[model samples]
Target: MFSGLPQDYSSITVTNDGWWPDTDVADFQSQRSIPASIKTETVASALLMAIGEANAELAAYQSAQRAKGFSSAKDVTGPSAGGVNQLCAQYLKIIFARAKAELMGEITSAEREKANPGQQSEDTRDRLLAEASFAIRNIMGHPRVTVDLI
Candidate 1:
């Protein structure tokens, strides 16, 4: 439903209550305490990486869709239950995980103490992270190709 790019990657929702039901943002949120300010650079890197991985895993399908003149997942409308949906869902998870990593950060003893009078190190070891899972790939099923030998 996009004339150009998909919903600016940041807008991709992971909640089942959102457009895609296959995944729930809560599933990931339950793992990590997402931060308020994630860096743009970090978000872009994570989004690009997630896109590459998904395109690689679903290359044939992606190629076929491109061949049909649909540039990317954004061009897709909805079945609400299909490849594009799954890809976007997975992509969102990855972006969230990578971006959130920066939020759940740790500072050295000198670092934290510098800001506070008696503070020590900011140990982020206890911080939880949402690992990007590929459940959508399995849910979407295998990519198929027509084998014709001349």
Candidate 2:
């Protein structure tokens, strides 16, 4: 319940569909503690952007998986939760973190507008992005960092 206001059923819906796992707006909001003031459209936009970015980042890995007879992320063998693929879970983490980071500024503004007055620090957003990057690397079976002699 947000500010005791009536819920926007429409906003609870995910605005886009794609080849990757579908993003549940309601789930994202709940898991990330998104306020109603941020509007579903804003969140959906951020999600779409994050999906695009993640897809772009994973293109090569996806291709390799396809070459190995896995047509989609879901087809790749991995640990499963409630039958959900681990890769799918990690992909959700990537998008959720990216989307939340993208909304940090709007979240702060919305909080201030609602008289909540809590600041969303840059460090928080950076951490969210780092989480996304970590998830990406995890799915890719790559280390979180690389070192090279210069």
Alpha-carbon local distance difference test for all models: 0.41, 0.81
lDDT of 2 by residue, 56-131 (tens): 9988888888789876677778789887899988999999999999999888887774555344777888899999
- Model 2, global lDDT: 0.81
For candidate 1, the lDDT comes to: 0.41
Model 2, runs deviating above 4 Å:
1-18, 113-119
What local lDDT does model 1 show for residue 75?
59
Task: Find the 10 residues in a row with the least total lDDT in model 2.
Answer: 9-18
| lDDT score for residue 90 of model 2 | 94
In candidate 2, residue 142 scores what lDDT? Answer: 89
Candidate 2: Cα lDDT at 122 = 79
